[model samples]
Target: MATMQSLAFSSPISSHRPHQQRSHTGLISSPWVICQSTHSSFNGQSLQLPQPRRVLLRGSSKLTGAITMMVKPVIQFIQGTDEQTVPDVRLTKSRDGTNGMAIFSFDEPSVFDSTGELGEITGFYMIDEEGVLSSVDVNAKFVNGKPARIEAKYIMRTPRDWDRFMRFMERYSDANGLQFVKK
Candidate 1:
């Protein structure tokens, strides 16, 4: 029945500079930065190619009034299907300031010197806030069975905030059916 929350994907900044082909050309130098990633795959098709990293963490200065941003972005997640824990329970996508908006946290790591890309995370960045739709809380733990991935990306500066966060993740995945996990 088109499960996985009616399917929704693309936020790894559009799989290679794809914020509708971003290139606003202010000379590409604006400190309010974002984008962090880790990737690896097999059956999902990605022998290795999805490792993006960039974080300038826009400077925010405005205490108790209205706008208070704090971005600690770095994403890419895998390991799910558990009522409690196992497979590295994860989700961590952070961003603050520049008004781009981002905050999703759900990661579970008790002890993992390194291990990733087991299964679960296949997509990233889904936001909706008020109605309740925020699933991204970056993650990373290297050196395990030899394959687990997490890749993060964020881009917006007009395109109407990337079409208002892609229509609030497409109405939060068509009102919560949930699909948007990619390699």
Candidate 2:
């Protein structure tokens, strides 16, 4: 077991107070980043620890770029579901990991039942060999009262939550035969 050690800060950290206004969800291309201590690991193996705390990281452009590479995942398209492969559909998440949106055109809108014999709206989920990565209640756009395309938004309010999602994506991509490319 790798011993957990405190990362001493050169400058004493002041009490952190979250801003009342929420930070806008955007890509982390700039030279600033936020961080939190959620998981610990050794030699590429993850170890879940009992201590839970928030970590904020602010440093030079070099540090920012390195952290960005670690957290910023290559965006990907959801090829299809377990039953079949559907093309031209993609999922995008905010760089800060606040939220994600998935959208695709509905070729056969008539097949949609809106409610699957239940009172709740239709929902979409991405499940791999392991389990569901994320899910959201589906909403569709219409043209002349006919469904044209569908979209769903899921939320992950913190960087920690986003990290978990990325782990799921790693496994989901492997099982689904999907590849993420930088463009």
Candidate-wise lDDT, in order:
0.32, 0.38
Question: Which candidate ranks first by TM-score, i.e. highest?
Answer: 2
Clashing pairs in 2: 35-55, 36-55
Per-prediction TM-score: 0.23, 0.37
Model 2 lDDT on a 0 to 1 scale? 0.38
Model 2, 66-99: lDDT tens digits are: 2231212222123121212222335555654455
Task: Estimate, for each residue in 144-182, the C-alpha lDDT of model 1 and write its tens digit.
Answer: 653233323444444345444544453333332334563
Total clashing pairs in model 1: 28
lDDT of 1 at 104: 35
TM-score of 2: 0.37
Task: Go through the candidates in order and give the C-alpha RMSD of each one to the true structure.
Answer: 17.9, 18.9
Relative to the true structure, candidate 2 has a C-alpha RMSD (angstroms) of: 18.9
